[model samples]
Target: MDLYFLGTGAGLPSKRRNVTSIALRLHDERGTFWLIDCGEATQHKILSSPLSLSKLEHIFITHLHGDHIFGLPGLLGSRGFQAGEKPLVIYGPRGLEQFVETTIRLSETHLPYRLWVSVIDGGVIFDDEQMTVTCRQLNHGIPSYGYRFEEKPKRGKLRQTLLQEQGIPAGPIYGKLKEGHDVALDDGRVLRSADYLAPPTPGRVVTILGDTRPCDSAEELAEGADVLVHEATYAASEWERAQNHHHSTATDAARTAANAGVKQLVLTHVSARYDEEGEAKLLADAQAIFPATTLAHDHLIINVPRLPG
Candidate 1:
């Protein structure tokens, strides 16, 4: 799986970066894209990427902040105009339905496809055969949430060489072996699938947090994640300001990653004060606390491979 940062700035859009928005591309696995926090002008950001808005199947909003959800109405309307026939589901905190209904009513925007909105509390919001998504309440200025995306483990590959060595002809029986099924030959000899199958491959876990202060809930949600994407809205010198505004600094984000035992920490939602030349300081601050740390920028795509056991 991979994560595409459509916008990584904090508070508002700037010439170098846009507001908070991320697209979790799952096309190869599920043939759809999952969006997290659609900030202002998010659809415009997707236009610059290879992603198509029409393929967006799910949208998870963290809070009601303008910088986190101002682009929802426009994106929904544009998806219909762009020939999006598939159904779209949106999950968020309470009042999400009212917000979407009010915007569509006042603007008279018509959607071509069915729109499903779920305003839920902290729990598992979505689950299917392929993956599961869980949410927990976070400590923010408002009622915010953090999400954890866990992919289901898949069966191991069949040992073709072992089967060939046993004089077993390869055909539809290979599919059965891969599915962990035993086959019986005409001579009354039973061949067990476990004897010719490798161990199951582990799934990948990715955690994404919205605007919030450093809290235990964030750490719990990001426990042992392959990649943790947290908002670093300030520098280490602004610790007081970060606490007052319920935002996290680079050091705060790294500390959370270290506590959660995440393999890699991605610092996003950067403040506008830091220019291109000042980015190194941010990375250094985070790396000083946690060695596996990196700063995220606009249009930055991160490929998270499966973790080694």
Candidate 2:
């Protein structure tokens, strides 16, 4: 999986960055991408990237803030114009359904595809064959949330050589064995699937948080995640302002990642006040606490690698 940052600025846009939008691409695993946040001009940002509206399968909103959801209506409307007929599901806090419904109703927008809005109250919001998503409310000005995407562990490869050596002809039995099912041979022999399979491949975990203050929920959502995407809306020295605004500083984000024991920390949703020099300070502050910290830029792509078997 790969995280494509379409926008990274906080509150508003700047020459260096747009607002907060990210695309979690699962093309290799699911042939689709899940959008996280739909900040202003998100569709415009997608135009510059390789992402397509047709391939957008899900959308997750962190909060009702304009910087996080202003572009949602436009994106949804344009998806129809682009001939995107795939059903799309949106998950977000309360009022999300009303917001989308109101906008669509007022605009008289007729979506050709089906859309479902799930008002989540934390816990496991999504579970499917390939992945499970959990959410936790965070200390934000509004009902902001952090999401944890945990991919399901994959079954091991079938031991074709072992089966061939046993004179077991390859056919439907191989599929069953690969699925970890014990099979009975025609000759009255029982073959344990465990003995004919390699170790399962561990799935990757990614946590993406909304704008929030340094809080326990943030750490909980990011615990042991392969990548923790947290907002660093200010430098360490502005902790007072960050706290007052319910936003995290660079140091605060890194500390949370360290406490959570995450493999890597990614800082985004930067305040537009930061220039190139100020941005460097944010990175420095985060790296001082957590060495594996990355300052995300607009259109940046970060790979979340699966664990080795």
Candidate 3:
């Protein structure tokens, strides 16, 4: 899986960054992508990136903040032209449904596809055969939330070499065995799939949080995640300011990652007040707490690979 950062700035847009928007590309897994948050002018950011609105499947909003949701109406309206009759689902905090309905109604925008908005209440919001998504409310001075995307464990690889050694040729039977099914051959030999397969591969966990201060709920949602995308709106030196604004500092984000045992931590939602040197200091602060930390910028893509079974 790959995380494409479209806008990594906080509160407002700047020369180096836009607002808060992230595209979790799942092309290899589901042939579609999901938006974590739709900040102001998010569609414009997507236009400059390698993303298409036609493939957008779901949108998850963190809060009702303008920077986190101002682009929702525009993106939804534009999707009707590019996505044809594709259905879209949006999940967010309370009042989201009303906001979407009001905006679409007031603008007199007609959509060609069906759109569904779900109010998030902190729990497993999505669960399918391939994955599950859980949410928890965070301390953002508002009704904000964080999401945990957990991929289901995949079946083990087929032991092609072992099958070949047993004089079995590749065919439809291979497909069944790969799916952990037992099959009987024409010669009346029963081949157990477990005997001809490797151990099941473990799925990956990705945690993406909305704007928030350092809180226990954030750490719980990020526990043992393979990739934790946490907001670092200030450097460690601005801890008081960060706390006052209900935002996390770089050190705060890193501390959560270290406590959660996440494999990697990505610090985003940067404040526009920082220059190149200040941004470097933010990275340094985070790295001092958690070594596997990455300071995100616009267009930065983080590739997360699966773990061995």
Candidate 4:
């Protein structure tokens, strides 16, 4: 699994950064991509990345803010032009369904694929065999949310060496052993899979929060996450301004990550006021509190590796 940043700026688009949008690439996990947010000109930003509109199966909108949803109509229309027929599902706040329906209806944008729009409040919005996505409301000016993506635990490794030591050769029986089933060989010998199998490998947890201030819900959603993508819309010096806007400063995001025991923190939704040098200071401020912190930029691809047993 990997994460690709399409837009990392907060509020509005800028020369250095666009609005807030993130693509959670799941090619390795499920051969599909789950978009966290689609801000203004998001499709244009995806053109610069290696992502395809056809592979975008799911889109999770944080809020109804114009900056976070202005590109939805364009993206949906372009996906149809690209000949995408796969079913698309969108999970967002109550106003999201109306927004998409109104835009597509008024603009006469015809989508070839079936679209599933769900109004999500707080809870597990999506659950499949491989993973589960949970959402929680955050302390934002509007009704914003955060999503937690967690992969299911994988089966333990097959004890090939142990099987060989026990005079068991690879064959159809090996499949049963790998599936944690008791395999009876042609020679009437029963091989127990538990003896050869190790403990189940733990799954990776990724928490991507929407625009919010320092809140307890953010910490709860990000608890023990392998990667926590939080908003850092202001520098340390702008704490008052951040609070006024119900946004978080770099240090505020870092503190939340530390409290949540997150492994890595990727800060995004940066204010356009900060240039390259200012961004460095924002990164530094977060690193001072949480060492494993990185400031995200447009088109920044992050590889989220599975944890070692």
> How many clashes show up per model?
0, 0, 0, 0
Q: Estimate the TM-score of every prediction.
A: 0.96, 0.97, 0.96, 0.96
**Residue clash pairs of candidate 3:** none
Candidate 3, residues 69-91, lDDT tens digits: the string is 99999999999999999999999
Residue 299, candidate 1: C-alpha displacement in angstroms: 0.5
Of candidates 2 and 1, the better by TM-score: 2
Model 2 lDDT on a 0 to 1 scale:
0.95
Task: For each candidate in the order shown, give its overall lDDT on alpha carbons.
Answer: 0.92, 0.95, 0.94, 0.92
| Candidate 2 per-residue C-alpha lDDT over 188-242 given as tens digits, one digit per residue, 9 for 90 to 100 | 9999999999999998999999999999999999999999999999999999999
Residue 278, model 1, lDDT: 74
Give candidates' CA RMSD values in order.
Answer: 1.5, 1.1, 1.5, 1.4
- State which candidate, 1 or 4, has the greater TM-score: 4
Which regions of candidate 2 fall more than 4 Å away from where they truly are?
none
Q: Model 2 residue 15 lDDT?
A: 89
- Candidate 1 lDDT over residue span 1-309, tens digit each: 799999999998999999999999998898888999999899999999999987798999988898999999999999998756789999999988999999998999999899999986888999998899999999999999999999988777799999899898899888888888998889998889898888777889999999999999999999999999999999999999999999999999999999999999999999999987677888899999999998998899999896533
Q: For candidate 4, report its TM-score.
A: 0.96
Query: Once superposed on the true structure, which residue ranges of model 4 sit more than 4 Å away at CA?
Result: 185-190
